[model samples]
Structures are given as C-alpha cells and as structure tokens.
Target: MDVLIIDDDPTSVFLAKLLLSSTGLFDKLTTYQNPVDALSFIKVQLVDNQLPQVILLDINMPLIDGWQLLDALMPYQAQIQAKYWK
Candidate 1:
C-alpha cells in the first residue's frame, strides 16, 4: 500500500517516517512539507487512480489545513478530474 505524509513540521515528518518505516508496511511512502504541493500531488494521483491508500495530514498548516484538503478532494466523491480546480 502507498502512504502520504503532509506536515509542515520537519520533526513530525521525520518521527512519523521513523515509526512508519520501521513497520515496513507500505510500498511507497511520500512526504510533503507544503500543503499546496501535497494537494497538487493528490490531484495528480487521483486523476491517475494512484491516490495513496492512506494520508497522514496535519490539521494545523499555514496555507491550508487538513480539513480544507479534504474539502477540495470532496469533489472526487462523485467523479474526479484534474479540471475540478484548474
């Protein structure tokens, strides 16, 4: 399974990687320090049907929070397309 980590804290991301990596449960692990970049990645992945099986999102972020990210992706609940936002 694939996993995504979207947190602004480098320490948190590091610790999360340490813990999750130790378990050796995921096939692909990706991390992003910026919410916008993470969102864009998710959008591309969603379009390609490669969305991560799990996403470790930070509730508190600078530009966009976890809830906002989820809100943006909500469009996928029906039918997703790259044009949804662009």
Candidate 2:
C-alpha cells in the first residue's frame, strides 16, 4: 500500500513516517509540507495510476487547509474514489 502524509509540522511528519515505516505494511510512503505541492503531485499520480492508497491530511495548514484540498480535488473525486475502492 502507498500512503501520503500532508502536514506542516516537520516533527509530526517525521513521527508519522517513523511509525508507519515500523509497521512494514506500506510499499511506498510520501510526505509533503505544502498542500499545494501535494495536490500537484497527486494530480500527476492520478494520471499515472500511482495514487496513494491513503492520504493523511492536516486541516490546519496555512495556505490550503484539508477542506480546501478536498474542494480542490472535487473534480477528481470519482477517479480518486475509484482508486480507494480498489
């Protein structure tokens, strides 16, 4: 499984990565401090059929909060949900 973590706090990201890595369940793990960057990456991944199986998002981000990200992804909801259902 692939997982993507989006949070502004470096320590939180590091800890999450450490814990998830220790689980040894994920095949791929990615972290992004900037929600915009994460969104761009996700868009490309959607095209390549490499979307992350799980997205851990932080709602309190500065520029773009989790809600905003969800709204931004509204157009791709069907595709994203399809991947999730798989």
- Considering every candidate listed, which one attains the maximal lDDT? 2
Which stretches of model 2 miss by more than 4 angstroms? none
- How far residue 52's Cα lies from its native spot in candidate 1, in Å, is 0.5
Residue-level error in angstroms, candidate 2, position 5: 0.5
- Give the per-residue lDDT of model 2 (tens digit) for 1-86: 99999999999999999999899999999999999999999899999989888899999998999999989989998987787776
Q: lDDT score, residue 70, model 2?
A: 88
Clashing pairs in 2: none
- What lDDT would each prediction earn against the true structure? 0.90, 0.93
TM per model?
Answer: 0.88, 0.93
Residue by residue across 1-86, what tens digits does model 1's lDDT show?
89999999999999999999999999999999999999999989877888887889999999999899889888786554353434
Clashes of 2: 0
lDDT of 2 at 27: 94
71 Cα displacement, candidate 2 (Å): 0.6
57 in model 1: Cα distance from truth in Å?
0.6
Worst 10 residues of 2 by lDDT: 77-86
